[model samples]
Target: MEFRVLGAVEATADGAPVDLGSRKQRLVLAVLLLDAGRPVSRDRLVDLLWPADPPASARGTVQALVSRIRAVFRAAGGPELVTEGPGY
Candidate 1:
């Protein structure tokens, strides 16, 4: 799988475009990509996403979004793109 983030956040497989879902999902993916091989904590994601005001369920929301992204990558034949440890 190939990812493009220069302008639009995009992912492609075998020259075919992959649907990355909502704007929030794209944003999450962008952050992870920008971080590359580093782990991004849930707190960091919540901060990056909400900044001023994060909801009580921000962490759960982040997990859901990340799970969806993982499904997308899995369908695209991506090689274990996002892994969970201390973070994603």
Candidate 2:
């Protein structure tokens, strides 16, 4: 799988485009990709996802979003989403 973050944040598998879901989902993916092999803490994700004011359930929301992203990539036979410690 190849990911393009240069413009519009796109993902391609086997030469075909992959649907990355909503804007926030794409944002999450972008954050992960930017970090690449590094781990991004849940707190950091919350800050990035909701810069203005994060809700009480921000952590849970991030988890849910990560789950959805993992499922999408898994179904596409793409890269594995690894969870290490408190981050994804």
Candidate 3:
């Protein structure tokens, strides 16, 4: 499994590109990768995902994005997305 954030946020498995879904999902993965091995708080993610006004469903949106990302990794037989405390 390889994650690239230098040029563009990208994930590849076995040399094949891994689809990361939407732009927001990719951003979530990038943020998490930047803080790898550390638990990123939900509030922090909310702020990053929506800097101006975060809707009431912002938390759920993050979770859904994480879930989608995890599914992609899981299907690709890559790394596991670990959930720690209030974050993923």
What C-alpha lDDT do the candidate models reach, one value each? 0.90, 0.92, 0.91
Worst 10 residues of 2 by lDDT: 71-80
> Which candidate number would show the highest TM-score if scored against the true structure?
3
Q: Write the per-residue lDDT of candidate 1 for residues 4-84, one digit (tens) a residue.
A: 999999999999999999998999999999998899888898999999999999999999999999899899987575556
After superposition, candidate 1 runs with Cα above 4 Å error: 82-84
Q: Which stretches of candidate 2 lie over 4 Å from their true place?
A: none
Question: What's model 3's lDDT at 16?
Answer: 94
> Which candidate wins on lDDT?
2
Show the colliding residue pairs in model 1: none
User: How many backbone clashes can be found in candidate 1?
Assistant: 0
Ranking by TM-score: 3, 2, 1
Q: List the residue pairs that clash in candidate 2.
A: none
Judging by lDDT, tell me the better candidate of 2 and 3. 2
Superior candidate under TM-score, 1 versus 2: 2
Off by over 4 Å in 3: none
Q: Give per-residue CA lDDT, model 3, range 1-88, as digits (tens).
A: 9989987899888999989899999999999999998998888999999999999999999999999988998899978889899987
- Give the Cα error of residue 88 in candidate 1, in Å: 0.6
lDDT (10s digit) by residue, model 2, range 29-86: 9999999999989899999999999999999989988998998899789889999999
